[model samples]
Target: MTGLLAFTVLVALVGLERVAELVVSVRNAAWSKARGGIESGQGHFPFMVVLHTGLLVGALVEAWVRRPDVAPVLAWSMLALVLASQALRWWCIASLGRRWNTRVIVVPGLPPVVSGPYRLVRHPNYVAVVVEGVALPLVHAAWTTALVFTVLNAGLLAVRIRAEDAALETLPRSTEVEHA
Candidate 1:
């Protein structure tokens, strides 16, 4: 029963973290709108929601319901990745400021953000995501979750990255900014 309670609390915390992300997205949208940014990818929004939601459910089911004990080394390693993911996520948020949205919103005249995490990699957030997708499940020895989401996210990322690049290219900021 204690294990169950602990597991439930963890799930709730994860959900809350997602809610916090949504709040950031909302704030970002307001800023983008004020800047006359044109947001696209309406069609992709729902799919992203579904996929992220599934990840939560999948992790709970694999980790809690199934109650698999992960290898100590693997769990520690994944925990490290999860911690790194949090750091990177915040880095992206801070670097992008109000320009970052859950959806693609391109503000004209605002050069594509190229600082902090972006300076190191064009898509550091995605890197965090890919790492977390595998790490979260692996922390509990949920190989099934790791394998499935990794593959699915990979495909989704291809489309997502292309769309984001195309959107960024049109922003006025791109005129003088070079893609790193």
Candidate 2:
């Protein structure tokens, strides 16, 4: 298969992985709601959904329509970053377990989780998100998508992270630094 075809397949696989994440998010959301979890950032949820979906669609469209030349070194390096981002994302889900969802929900009285990737950074998932945003498109030389997504996502994340921090604040603080 040609490089473009392979990149398409890769993007399709990532899309499928996104579906899997939604499945988990839905289940976890229900679980959280059952426990009286308060959700913040609802206002931005729709935009987040559109932007993330657009990431996949935009990357594929640019790759096919623009037919950008994919250098082997760049493609391989970006592919590695994409895979690493996925791994980090899943690690976050595993660490948070039922506490993890696409929406920002915090269970009152519960202490912030400081384990796994959270130990290293306050929002490791977002780190994964930023890396994937740039790396995935550049894997196929979809620079426009990469640039657009990064800019839009940065604005979205600024709102999202603030909302998340505010929601997490409802939980009781622990002696350890809060990184959930």
lDDT of 2 by residue, 122-171 (tens): 99999999999999999999999999999999999999999999888878
CA lDDT of each prediction against the hidden true structure: 0.78, 0.93
Residue pairs with backbone overlap in model 1: none
lDDT of candidate 1 over 1-180, digit per residue (tens): 454445456556767878998999998898888879788767777888888788878887877767876567986787788778878888888778777778889877678877777877988989988998888777767788889999999988888898899987885544234321
Q: Please estimate how well model 2 matches the true structure, expressed as its whole-model Cα lDDT.
A: 0.93
Compute the lDDT of residue 64 as modeled in candidate 1: 73
Q: Candidate 2: deviation at residue 106, Å?
A: 0.9
Best candidate according to TM-score? 2
